[model samples]
Target chain A: MTSVRQRLVPYWLLAPGLIWLIVFFVIPMYYMGELSLKTGSIDTGYQLTWAFSNYTDAISQYSTQFFRAFYYAGVATLLCLLIGYPLAYAIAFKAGRWKNLMLFAVVAPFFTTYLIRTIAWKTILDDSSPVVSFLKTIHLVPQDGRVLATSAAVIAGLTYNFLPFMVLPLFAALERVDIRLLEAGKDLYASATQTFLRITLPITMPGIVAGVLLTFIPASGDYVNATFLGGTNQAMIGNVIQSKYLVVRDYSEAAALSFTLMAIILVALIVYIKFAGTEALMGDEEEAE
Target chain B: MEGSSDLPPTDPESDQPGETAGNTARSGSGGVRLEGVTKKFGDFAAVHDMDLDIADGEFFTMLGPSGCGKTTTLRMIAGFEQPTTGKVLIDGSDVAGLPAYKRPTNTVFQSYALFPHMTLEENVGFGLKRQKVPKAEIKKRVAGELERVGLSREAKRKPNQLSGGQQQRVALARALVNLPKVLLLDEPLGALDLKLRKGLQVQLKEIQRDVGITFVYVTHDQEEALTMSDRIAVMNEGMIEQCADPETVYDRPSTTFVAGFIGVSNLMPAVAKGPGEIEIADGPTVPTADAAQFSSGEKCFAVVRPEKLTVSLPENAPGDQPGIDGIVESSLYLGTSTQMAIKVADDVNMTVLVPNASEDARQHLPGGGAKVRLNWLPEHMHLVAESDPGGSDADQTSTDQVTEGVNS
Candidate 1:
């Protein structure tokens, strides 16, 4: 009886967290999925019709917006990589005694409200602002220029917001590098550049994948940067969902689009796991051991 | 210093003795020379003015306790960590500011650090690929290296798929593929269990012999150092206490740290009684070793190796021979020999080793305070300062303090 009770104890311990996940995640996803099959109008309360064309209609109407969001997110993720990889490498391998300090600095901006931080960037991009004036001096900003409501600004915003996410994963990947492998590469008559390309870059692919996943998914979902900095031409997928629910008063369309986004994300994750190997993406201890 | 740069490494049957000497001064023996090398991290010195010459093809082992300077010395030689106050020369060239990749040394780290994504061949070929060697040449060299390390069949396997020993061999082959003048191994076999460790010890020695490359091996395991290295540099407290051939290091330690650290010894305090004689207690004069090396009134320690001390009954003993009285507290049959802990005087106990020969009487030794005599040859008695066992009390306690904690 005691042994049976011991087995039951694990379930008892796990009960609360499991219950929380089901209620918050599973039920909400199920309901949202169901609601996507229903129609919602300003005159009528939500009602289920099992009309699957709502998904088709949502896709057809917002195809341009959905594809544009993915393209922009992809570009933003690439920019994050271009900037983050070297920074992460520098911090991971070259910082030495200052490594902890560099890591802390990379993560420091996260301590504040992200919304407030993005707003500050909005202020800094104002035409009359000091940053704009300085950029103009450097020929980076044109006279009478306004960065807000521009597509470039939105990309810049997305890149900035996700830079830390990309850098952290890249740093983690690079830091786990066995110092000996680098030495081995050097010994094999590998020049320093060759070592980085053949050894360092390939080894950090998992980190690159993780960083892209983090940057792209969040950038695609982020309407804040679009609303604050991106113009009408630069509106993303998040904006499409928002407008569907508020302007068109189409809850079903919005629901359908949300599920569509979730599906694409899932597909991307599956593809990444397939190619990158699920083993490479596991926890550090698992990989190290 | 000694071997060809191009041909594959092999353990030549005729080269065994000279292989041990590693006098390959054709590249001429100046593989890594440290002159007063010291490394200080803040106020704590990891290596203190470490001066040593590692020959081009010498398989030298730097050995010590965990916090000692062995790893630091290896790092200095590899150009990973810079010495705060000295020069590190590689291949007779002062590479004081050279980065690790720029140095003529390659390291096989404790963790093999194999590239997880690459196959064994690709991993071995990585350095060559980096140097922009033709892919065909890279393939050929990688094949040769993999063959050398006994991993030719597993060249398609990733490091994760290989066994630990296989992974270690792969790491070795990867470094050797580069043809570094100096190959530094930093406790490379530490992670292996005892049986596997012993196997690798033989393999490493054989590989060093074959390659004829200067190998600077760092380890805390004295047995590994003694077995694999041409010379063992026993280090403690950021300094090389003694660097010599294994037998000389074990048989004639210059300091108490080297004596205790390398092998077992009974460190006992003895008063200097007279010339060529020292009193070890309320006892007859034990033959002295170099009384001139010590003042007659000063305190010094008398050392007796367990194997050197013969345990015999008083009646059966040589009539004129002098010895200590003791009772065998306990005895253990260790396959080849019997080892006994004998209570000599008061609570002080001395260990004695007896060969397991049938002619050697397996006298059932008496326990606790049973009278017995311990005798050894006159020249076997070695003397050093009395404080050698515990070292300087201040330094000992501070080491204890460092181990127990750090401010950080």
Candidate 2:
């Protein structure tokens, strides 16, 4: 009896988290799957008649919005990587006594609400604002052009909002890299640039993969940035799904579109993880030795 | 073995093959040289004005305790840290401005800093790859190095997958594959267990002999230094106390610091009496070698190895030998020998080691509180220079300097 109770202690410890996940994730996913295949208007009450055409119709009507969403998100993720990596590296390796202060500065903007921050970008990128006027003077923007509502504005906003997600993980990875390994690289005849490329970059790859995922996934599903900064021509799949649920009252199409977007992202994630080997995720296992 | 072919052909004269005759004019050898080298972190000097000359194919060791500047000297030779005011030369040429990568020296780091993500093959081949060696040659040399270190079967495995000893061997093969002019090892086996360290010590000496490269090793282990080094430089407080062969260093330590640091020695405070005698404080006058170096009434230490002293009953003690009477304070059974602490004076204690060669020897050994006479030949006693009055203060500051070196 004692041994049986001892064996059951682990399951007792696991109960709360398992129950929470099943209740919040599993049940909602099942309902969403059911609603995706139903056919009905909001007034008529949906019926699960296995209308597979709902998915095909949603894909055909909104393919352009889907492509734009992925494109914007991909560009934003790349921009975040370019801007965040050096900042994190400097903090981790070179900022002797000021490392904590710089790291706090990296996440300082989060004190403001995300919606308010995105709204603030609107005033900064206004037509006659100092930023746009300076760009116009430098011929980066034409004399008659504006910066308030464009694909660039949406990308810029997405990059700014998700940059900390890229930096913190990168800082963690770069900090764990042993200084002696860099010394060994130099002792083995690797130049400074070669040392960075061959040793530092490969070791920090897990952080890069994580940063890409964190920045790309949310940027793809976000409609707030597009709503505030992008014009009608830049409407992403997120904007279409928002209108499909609220304005059109097309419950079945919205559910199908959500499932479609999830399936594509899942496939893309699988392919990305395949190319970037799963060994990186398992790489943390061997460091303790 | 095919692995041995990759080693530089042993030129008994110079060790290196491409050196021109004119290049060896200044140093008269193809190895490393340091002239007036000093490394200071802010105001504290980690390595004081140091001068060293390591010959080709010599297995030299810098032995000292922690914070004794041995590692700092090794770093200066490896070009990791530049000397503040001196020149570091490799193979008879001044490499003052050369970076670590461009210098003809390599270091096996104390931590065995293997590239964790890379396989053993890649780790060993990294230097050759940086040198732009052809792919086929790189593969051949990498396999040769892995086989040389007995890690050929695990070439595809990463460092974390290997044991500590195996990772250390991989680190060795990685640096040796480059065929550097001088190989610097900063306490490479300092992390291993005792038995493993002993095994690797012999193996490392054999490898140095086979490669015939100048090896400058740094270690805090005195026994390891004695076992492997062709010559040992015993250092303390940012300066070398003595640099000599192992036997000379053991038999005749020049200073009290060297005598105490190298092995167990009973150093008794004494005042020089004449040309061949020193009077022990609160005890008897003893005959000593090199007593002529000190003036009468000069304060010094009379040093004797513990193994050189014999204990016997007062009646059985030899009449011709110098002897001191003491009471045994404690006895430790050390398997091969019985070590006893003898109280010779109120404040001075002397250690004596008696070999346990027979059952009768162990049975006759004195216990605690037993009175015994310690006897030794006159030649066994050595008089060392007096220790510094501010020695404890210097030790305290050197430790602080070491911490500062680590932080910087």
Candidate 3:
């Protein structure tokens, strides 16, 4: 009876959060799916025509925008991995006693509101600003082009915005890598480089893949960065969706685009999980680590 | 015979690889020597100036409580932790500053620390592969090592797929495949359950005998050390209290800590009544010449094992024998033998192991306290220098820190 009560305590505690998410989060997604299927005549209150054209129309009209956002998001995700992985490694294995302080430093920027932080980035990257002029003097910044509004700027914004997500998982994964395994690797004759390449990297791949997924999804759907950093030439699919709903007043087409985006991400997720989940050889490392 | 390709059972101490293999450059000729080896983390000393000489191909074990610096000493020998003050010589060369990878020695860590990314064969092959051995030789050697550990057939299996015992074998194979001068084991059987632990203890001794490599094992478990090691160094507070054979260490402990730590030794406050006689608490005068260092009436302790003390009724006891009369407080039946906690000196308790079973429950005495005689030979009691009469404070602050320093 006592064991049963102890077991029930967890379920009881989970009940509220599960219910709230189901009611507020899951139910809305369901309604959105329902909304995606309907056809409305504005005055008819809305009839469920169950028309399949809504899905096709969403694709044909926004193919270019969708492809561009995914391409930028993919680059941002890769860039985050390249930057976050080495930073996490240095912090986890080499930082020693200062690890807690370094982790806090990583989190400090996150405490600021996202929009405010991104808006601040606009002024920092102003083409006419002293910093940009200073960089141009050093031959670092391209003197001919402005960095404030470009495709590269959009990717840089996405990379900066989602950096924390990448760093967090990478830090956790690298932190959990057994120092003993590294010793074992060294003893087994692996050089420092070999040990990192063969053992550390493989063991933390799950975190790399997780970080990529987290950064890519949000960056792809983010209109804030595209609007502030990218000009008319580089507005992502997120901006297109926003324009369809608010600027063009095309709710049906917007809902169709949202559904299409969700489907593509869902399929990508299935594929990602297939490679980076159970078959990823992560849990095996976790056991020893 | 059909599954002969599986891991071969091993006794490393019996196998002679080479002086430069397991033995460090310090011990090129094959003997392991530690000269004033001291390990200090900041101001705290983990291993005090330790000087030890381990014979070639000997199963030497550093035995102690959890923080006694035995493992620290082992790690020093393995080059995982360099000695702060002294030199660690394997053959004849000093590995004072060399990192673990540069040293010839290899260690089987308590956690095994097997690379999960590698299969059994890959793990075993790792050391040789790192040396860039020829492909054919790596295959042959890896196969040979897997066969040695009795895991040849399971070479393709990941570490998690294997049992704890099998994983340990793989770890051993990984180390032995390097063929270091000395194989350092840091509580290798610590993670296993009791039954498995006992079984592995025998297997370890057997494997050491078969391989003939110098085995420097570190453990807090007395039985494991006693059963396997040719020489056992009992350590306390970063220093070796005693280094001798298991029988000598058990039979003749030089200090109060060793006598208390090795086995169940009943400790009692006693004074040097005469050369070989002492007045004990709540008991008749006992003869113990081993404690003659102290002058008459100076405070000391008589250390005697519980098994050495004979228990009987006053009537059945030898005529005029001096013994402490106590009652059997509780009798614990442990299969072939039974143990009883007897109250000898007031609230003081002593446990006695008896091989015979009692036909009837004799609990007629109040609180299981009955009149019984506790008798033993004069040589059984080892005289330990007692700092205080009560020894209350001695028991309060434990030797946990020293044990942790060595093991952790």
Candidate 4:
């Protein structure tokens, strides 16, 4: 009896999380799937009519927004990686006694509300602001060009908002690297750049994959940055979904769009994992052991 | 200086007997030389004003307790660390501005530091690949090196898949594949269990002989150093206390630190009276071999090895021999010998080791709380300089402090 109880212990331990996922995730997903296949409007009572055209209609109508959303999020994720990698490396290896202080500074923006922080960028990038004037002087922006409400502002906002997600995982991976391995690389006739490429970069690959997923997934589905910092030209699929659900009250169209976005993301993630290798994710678990 | 010269010719096939001498001034002889090398980290000096020469194909060991600057000295040779104000010469050429990647030296780290992401073959072939050796040549050499270390079957395995001893062997192959002029090993077998360490010690010595490369090894284990080294440089407090062959280092330690650090020695506080005599503190005046080296009334230690002294009942002690009377406090039976702790003076405790040849010998041995007399020949007592600060007590407490400093 005791042996049997011991075998069931893992299931018992997993009970709470399994229950939470079933209630919050699986049930909502089922309703959303049903709602996507219905013929629905606010004035007329909604009915599940198995209308699969709702998905095709939503995709055809807002294909431009879908493309814009993916493009902006992809560019933002790349920018975050380029900026955050060095910052994380510095904090992990070179900060010395100042490591904790620098890490705190990286996370300090979290103390303020996310919406407020995005609005603050609006003022900083205004046409009359010093930032725009400096950019104008440097010829980065033309004398008449303004930064606010453009694609640049929306992309910059997404990059800044999701940067910490990139940095923290990279920092964790870099910190776990034994410093002796770097020294060994040098001893084995590898130049500093070669060591970074062959040793440090490969060891920290799991962190890169995780950071990309964390930043890209939410940024693609986000409407706030586009609503505040972008004009109609910069609006993404998120904005279309918001307008369909709230302004137009086209429930079936909104549900269809949401399902389409999720399915696309799933397929993209599968292809990515296939290319990058599932071993990268498994590497993190081996390190823990 | 005397210790090094007195060493028996280690390699009978070698041409010169004095080739291992540190002061020979044979520069550019395809070996390593450190002249006035000192390393200071802020206000703390890790190594200070060290001058050493390791001959080509000689297995030299830097043996010391922790925090004794052996690793720092090895790092300077490997070009991982630049000396504050000295030159590091390898194969007769000054390598001051050169980085480690360009230096003709490789190091086996204490932790084995194998690339976790790469297979065993990839890890061993890393240096050759960096040197741009041809692809076929890399594969051939990597396979040969792995087979040499008995790890060829596991070439496809990552480092985490192998055992610790196997990982250590892979680390050795990784460095040796480069065929460096000088190979620096920082306690490579330190993490292994005792039995495994002993086996690897013999294997490492054989490998050194086969390769004929200048091997500069660093370790805290005295037995390992004595077993493998052609000559051992015993260091303490950022400096070398003595450098000599294993026999000379064990039998004739020049300083109190070397005597205590290398083996268990009874350093009884004594005052030199005149030629061939010294008065032990609160004990008898005994005959010493090197009393002429000290002035009259000079303070020193009457150093004697534990196995040199024979213990017997006070009544059965020899009448003609000069000896000390003490009370045996305890006797512990070691596998091959019985060790007795005898109190000679009010404060001085001496250790005596008696061989357990047979059951009859064991029956004749003294037990705890028995009055006894310890006897040894006049030549067994060696007079050494007074123990210097931070050099005297080679006990567990100081060992712990040194271990902590090195780890931190």
Candidate 5:
């Protein structure tokens, strides 16, 4: 009896969180799965006839939105990497006494609501704003062209919003890199560029992988940035799902779209993990194991 | 092994076939000369005005406690650091503006900073590949260097997969494969255990001899310095107290810092009594051969090694130096010898090392609290000018400097 109680202690400790996940997540997911297969109409109330055609219809009609969502997310994630890598490297290895301050600044955007931040970007890229006017003056944008309500603006918003997610992981990873290894690279007659590419970058691969995943996952299903900054032509899968659920009240189609997005993300994550190597995913504990 | 068939025959003496010969001129034979080199981090001088000349094919060591500017000096030589006020010349050419990569020098870091992501083979071949050495040549040289370090079997293993000692060998092979003119080792054996450090010390010396490359080794372990170096520079508070061969350094230390740091020394306060004699504080007057090095009544320290002093019955011939009467305070039986601490005076304690060469010698050591006599020949007494305390002060000041740098 005592041994059985001892065995059950671990399960008892896990009871709260496990129950919460089941109630709030697993059960809702099961109902949504059922909803995706049900034949539904508002006038006659919803009826469950196992209408699996809802998935096929959703995918065939909204294939463009699915492709656009992944494309924009991919480009935004790449931009975050190119921009956040140097920021993280500088803060981790080069900031000296200002390291803490720079780190605080990296996460400082979290103080304000994310929606407000996206709205601020919309204002900043307004047609008559100085930024757009300056871009026009520099001939970067044609004089007749505008910055707001364009795919560029939407991508710019996603990159900006997700940049901190990219930076913190990269910073944490880059911070653990030994300065001695870098010096050893130079001592071994590797140029600065070579040292960075061959030594610094490879050692921080785990961070890069983590940052890419964090930025890509949410950016793929995001709708607010599109709603605020992009046109109807640039609408993503998340925008389509949001309109289907609320504006059109098409529950079955919306449920099908949500499941499809989740499935795609899950598959992408698996492929990414396979390529990045499991040793990295396990982190510092890999050595002990 | 068949990878060499595709490459044309090439002379091994040529450092790198595709690269310009500028970096190869000093290959295999390079000497370093530092003229008035001083390094300053902000206003705190880590190394004072230093002038040192290291010969080609010499195993030279900069020996000092931590934070005494030995590592800083080594970094300057490796081109990782530029001197604040002096020139660092390698092979008769000043490399003031050259970066570490452009200089024909490699360093085995104290931490053995092996690239954790790369396998041993890739790490060993890194420099050659950067120089664009032929692929076949890279493979052959990498294997040879790995075998030299006795790690050929572990070539495909990542650095993290190997033990600390194995990783250390990999670091050594990585630098040595490049065949640089000068190899700088910044306390490379510092992180190893005693047995491993001792074993590697012999191997390191042998490899240096075999390669005939100028090795600038920095270490604080006096035994490591004595055992491996052809010559050692004893540094204290950013200044070199003495630079000499191991025997000369142990036999004739110029400064109290050198005498105290390199080994255990019985430093007793004394005053020059007259020609050929000096009187210890509240103790006996001891005779010396060279009283000319000091003036009459000048303050000095009578520095004598523990091995030089003998403990025996109080009996002496006429005209012989008088022995000190002391009570044995403690005796520690080290494997080959017994070290006894004798309180000669109220505050002065003298140490004597009694070798267990014979049964009779071991029988003569007295129990604790027993009276004994400590004596040494007049010629063995070394006179060092009284300087700021001794090694403890030098160690403490360097510690304070390190903490100050951190806190600021």
Candidate 6:
């Protein structure tokens, strides 16, 4: 009886966290899923009459916004990778005594609210701001052109806001790569660039995958940056869902839109993971084997 | 250095006595030379001014304890580390500023740093692929090298899939596939269990013999160095204490550091009384062939291996011969041999090894606190200079199994 009780101790320890998840996640998710299938206005109250047509309606009305959300998120994820990778790589391998300070700087923007930071970008890219005037003088942007209320502004904001998410995982992964492997590559007659491509890059693939997932997932559902920086033409699925739920009081459509966005993300993640190779995702366990 | 460059490295002239007397200068391909090489890490000198010439196809080992600069020396030769001052020559050409990729040398790292993502064949063919070898030829040679290391079946498997010893074999095959002018190994078997390490030692030596590539292996394991190296350079501090064939190094170590570091040395403070006679630390007068080298009244150490000392009951000892009388402090029965610690004096102790010829013989050996007499032949007693303070404390904690049996 004591031995059985000893085995039960671990479950007992885990019960609180499990209870919280079931209460908060499972219950709410089930209710929202049912709401996604109901058909009614807020004044009439929603009724779950197996009204699956809300999904079709949500998809048809918000298809362009859905595509735009994913497009901006994809571009932002790519930009984060381009900027975060080198920044993280420098911190991991080259920063020496300054590494901790550089890493702290990467996360410093989080001290300010993210919405405020996005608004700060709006001020920085205002039409009369020096950045826009400089771009005009360089003829990169026409004199009449504006940086705010554009898709570029939204994408840039998403990249900036989610960059730390990309950097931290990449840093963790790149830091785990054995220095001896790089030396071995050089010893085997690989040039510097070849060594980076053949050894350093492949070994840090898990970090890249993790960074992309962390950046892409939240960026796709982000509503604040689109509302503040993007015009109506640049509005995304997140904007539609937000306005539908809070402004138009269409809870069913909002829930349907949320479920569709989640489903699209899940499918896209599976496809991305497939092309990038799942072996790197299981890197630590594979190495232990 | 004594061997001519044109001769195939297997020529008998290569291992002739005194070939490593620092006399011969290499003229052409198939050798590496370090001329006054010194590596300093800021204020610390890791490798002092070192001059060494490794002959073509010879298995040379840089044997030392940790922090003794053997790995640093290997790194300088591989061009992974630049010498603080002086030149490193490969095939008689000064490769002063060359990088590792450009150097005609490859290193098998201690960790067996195989690319975890690459298959065995891809790993073994990496150097060839770097040189852009034709695809079919790369595949063929990769297969051939894999078979050479007895890993042909593991060609498609990733490095992580293989066992530790198997991964080591892959590392070996990968390095050998490059056909480098010199192969450097940095304690490659340091991670394996003892039984596996011993097995790999013989295989690694045989592979070196078969390939005829000048192998510069660094290891702190003295027995491994002795068994595998054609010549071993015993290092202390940042300098080479002694460099010679294994037998010569074991039998006639040039310094106190070499004697103690290579194996367990029972060093007794003694005075040279006359030729073939020496008086131990206020104890009995002993005989040694090396006593002739020292003048009477000069201080030296009478060094002898534990196996050389014969332990016997007082009654059974030779009647007239003088020997140190000690009480057995401890006795350990190793399968093939027996080890006993004998307390010769309050502050002095000596270890003795006796082969277990029969169960009766081991049973008859003295146990704790039993009186015993110790003696050895005059030729077995080596008179070394007094221990230098700088070298005494370094290798005490190093894990060299001195009781595994000395080469001598």
After superposition on all CA atoms, what RMSD does each candidate show versus the true structure?
6.6, 5.9, 6.2, 6.8, 6.6, 6.8
How well is each residue in A124-184 modelled by candidate 2, as lDDT tens digits?
Answer: 9989799999999999999988887799999999999999999998998899898899999
Among incorrect, acceptable, medium and high, the docking class of model 5 is medium
Model 1: residue B223 alpha-carbon error in angstroms: 2.7
In every candidate, what fraction of the native interface contacts is reproduced?
Answer: 0.50, 0.87, 0.63, 0.80, 0.76, 0.89
Candidate 3 off by > 4 Å? A1-64, A90-101, A251-256, A275-277, A281-289, B1-29, B271-299, B319-331, B341-351, B357-368, B378-381, B384-408
Residue-level lDDT for A200 in candidate 5:
91
**Which residue pairs clash in candidate 2?**
none
Q: Which candidate has the highest TM-score of all?
A: 2
lDDT of 3 by residue, B1-408 (tens): 232222233345532223212222123326689999889999999999999999988899998777779888988887778788988898788877877777778899899999887888888888888788898977876776666555666889888877777788889889987778888999998887666677677767866766677899999877777788899998888888789999888887766667666775466777788677888877778777675688888877777676777777767776555567788787665554556678887756666766655544333222345567777776666787743222342232223322332243
The global Cα lDDT (0 to 1) of model 3 is 0.77
Clashes of each: 5, 0, 49, 0, 0, 0
- Model 6, span A1-289: residue lDDT tens: 9999999999999999999999999999999999999988988887888888889998998899999999999999999999999999999999999999999999999999988998998888888899889989999888888888999999999999999999999999888889999999999999999999999899889889999999999999999999888898989899999999999999988999999999999999999889989987766535554
Q: Judged by lDDT relative to the true structure, which candidate is superior, 4 or 5? A: 4
Model 4, A128-222: lDDT tens digits are: 99989999999999998889889999999999999999999889989988899999999999999999999999999999888898899999998
Please identify model 2 stretches exceeding 4 Å from their true place. A285-289, B1-29, B389-408
Tens-digit lDDT string for candidate 6 (B1-408):
221211113335433212321212212227889999999999999999999989988999999888999999999999889999989998889999999999989899899999998999999999999989899978877876776566666689888877788888789888877788899999999988776787778878877766678999999888899999999998877889889999988888877778788777676778889888899985898767787888989988777788888999988997655578889998887788888889887756787889999999898898898999998777777888854645456335321445444322
**Model 1 chain B: lowest-lDDT 10 consecutive positions:** B1-10
lDDT of each: 0.77, 0.84, 0.77, 0.85, 0.85, 0.85
Interface RMSD of 2: 1.7
Candidate 4 per-residue lDDT over residues B305-348, each given as its tens digit: 88999888988998777688899987877767787889998867
Report residue B53 deviation for candidate 3 (angstroms). Answer: 1.8
Docking class of 3: acceptable
> Candidate 4 has what TM-score?
0.92
Return the lDDT, model 2, position B382.
Answer: 85
